[model samples]
Target: MAVTRQSVEQFDLDLSELHNDSTTVRFYGDYEEFEEPVQRRGKQTAAMRQGHSKDHRPDLKQLLYILTVSEDGGVPVYFTTDDGDKHDDQTHIPTWDLLKELTGRTDFLYIADCKLASSENLAHLHRQKGRFITILPKNRSEPRKMRQLLTDDPDCVSWKTLYEIRDEDGNLEHRFRTPREEEMTKDGYRLIWIHSLVKETTDEASRMKAIGKTTSELSRFRARLRSPRTLMRQRHRVQEEVEAILAKRPVGSFLSVEVIQEEEVTLKQATPGRRSKKTQYTKETKLRFDLSWKIDADALEVAKRSDGIFPLITNDSKLSAEDVLRAYKRQPIIEKRFSQLKTDSCVAPVYLKEVSRIESLLCVYFLALVIQTLIEREIRRAMDSSGIESVPLYPEGRACRRPTTRRLIDALSSLSHHRLQTDDGDTLSLYTQPTSLQSQLIKLMGLRPSSYGRKKN
Candidate 1:
């Protein structure tokens, strides 16, 4: 941690804002019998237990891997491996405290997901004079209240325009708006509701697709209701099936269903294979259920009114809503570090049963992540300083704006050295010539040219 802090200072990273998030690393061994973490012999080991696996591998034992990265270049500053069952909300306090200790301050804006929005977490940070920006979970009444308020009387809420940006096609790509604060959250924090034109269009398209699919199924079901082969007779059963279909998607709110019940009478011959006078006819009465549905135009309109809206909560009153939103947007950079941990570093499939070895392996993974990010950051920074936009790292000289560490390694993979034994009992060394691209990249990374050459004794 000290070394990482030193490196952050050396690189002049933006310590003003840091992002924290966690991912689960799964193990594939028979860990059904393992000792819990104990302080035996002055040593501590991480516990392997089953928790929420972000990788969606609950069948395998896992350790919750938490990371804190700088927004400057997504460089990982600190990481911890916790018991698999550790909840995300439970991690923020310790992480914030550690970052405070490392950065020597508590004023850095901590950005995380909704897990950081709990009353305890927010209150703790606020009390410590720490600032944070996080999304308001939909389950919270605050968001619903704002949505309801807006729906009831559209004019009741006032909005301030943030900015407008155009896309490559010269069309409006995004327009951001935030509700002017006429009121504050019950917790005395700023609740800024943002409206996005892009999100609104995307949401509307998704709703239309879902509605079309549900309506088609309902239409087919209604047609089957009139068919003689239809066996769905109970009204409650029919309603249950229709509700299930609607529940499959979020289009149920715009739909209203009615189950229509009717009685059908049929005559059947009691005696089979018999003639006219000897046969007895029996009358049967059966109930049939049909359905009628229509789109609730009023409900649809109400929903449309709030389309493309999301709420952000922050305690830092000095920053505007747009700045808070932009800071929260950087939260995904930490996810990139997690991706590198899993993919580039391959920090999974623990073949060791001992918790000590697992803990050591996690430490090595963290070190590897730091090294990888450093190399990536250095190269990108060099490119920016040299006024270069893209590099030919792809096949057939394709351009890459942001070169990845894996690609850089692949570019240098073919460089090799060979030793030849002479008849005079002397050895000669030969090295493959570096490609122009390799030389360019090597120079950009500011490595000594001899770093890739054969060493002289």
Candidate 2:
């Protein structure tokens, strides 16, 4: 572990900012066969247990995988396994300390998701003079206050556009923002609210679709109310049915429901047969129920005011809102590492039952991630330095401007070497020459072409 840390440090990659996240690696075997927290060589390690499976496989046992990566091209720097039952919030403190030790510094920025927003984690990092940025939890009072302010009078809160990125067609790709006024309190840290143009558009479209669906459903219910075979005989039943429909759909907030009652009178003859003197007309009153709904324009307006808004909390007052936004944006880099760890590497569904060996196997997987990241980083850097925009790494000679390590490995998968043995115990070796693309990739990666197959004497 020390040697690996030294190697990463030696590369001089950006250690100024680090991102952290966790996921679960599942196993199907009977992990219970081995005693958990078993002592091995005077050291105890936790065995597989059930937790909230990130892979959505709750039936299987798993180990919680905590990983941290540098913001420079998502190169993994630190990783550790935990008992599956542990929560992510509880792991952040230890992870921060481990990263501090690894980097031998305290001024670097630590970024993560909302799990790092807890008072304990934030307070601990602040006490140690370490800086961090993370998403604000919705349950916090500051966000509630902001939403209320925005809903009551949107102009009351001033906002400034932080930055914007555009696509090739001159379309807005994304934009970030923060409130122009100081949103911090004496007890609270710096709070920046971000608005995504894409999210706002999507939210509006989805809201309209849900409202339309609810309207159509209510029309059908109203038709049923007038039907003679309707089962909703009681007024409460009709109201309950309406509530159920609103609950299932996304239109509850913008919709209003009411049950209207009306009386119907019918006349009948006093006797079964018509009689001139003895017959008297009788009037019977029947109660009828109906439903009425309208879009709560006020509530809908309030929801619209807060669409596409997300908040971030940070203690570093020196960093501008854009800097914090950019740092927190790198949080997804760690997520990509988790993705490559699971999908590209196929690290799940372990075949081993022994818990000790499983832990060791995880270490090997971590090493593989490190090696793959190095190769990818090297190739990309070489491409940038040499003014190479794209490479033909895809199927049918398609171009890949930013190639992944998996695709690069697959491109070289067909190269092979053959060895023949004679009856007299003499041997001859033959190697297949690499294709132009393979040779180019090898050169970009600073590897010899002969490294793909047997070397010539």
Candidate topping lDDT: 1
CA shift of 373, model 2, Å: 1.1
Backbone N/Cα/C clashes per model: 0, 0
| lDDT digits (tens) for residues 1-457 of candidate 2 | 5845765777668888888999998887766754367887787776678879888888878888889888887888888888877789999999999899988999889999989988888989999999988988888887888788888888876778999999999888988776787567335688778887777878888898899998899999999988877666688888888988998777887888888877768888867886687788899877777889999888887789888888888889998888888888778877877888889989976888777788889888988998888788889999999999999988899999988899998998888888899999999878878988998999999889888766679
lDDT by residue for model 1 over 1-457, one digit each (tens)? Answer: 8878778878787788899999998888767655367553588766778778799888877888889998888888888878888899999999999999989999999999999999999999999999999988988998898778878887777788888899799898789988766447789988888889889999878888889999999989888888998988888788888989899998877988888889999989987876587788899999998888888878878877778888888889899878987888789889888888888788877788777777778888988888888889999999999999989999999999999889999999988888899999999989877778988888989985456765546
Each model's TM-score? 0.87, 0.82
Poorly placed runs, candidate 1 (over 4 Å): 28-30, 34-51, 57-61, 168-170, 212-235, 262-277, 285-292, 421-424, 453-457
Best by TM-score: 1
Error of 1 at 72 (Å): 1.5
lDDT of 2 at 157: 69
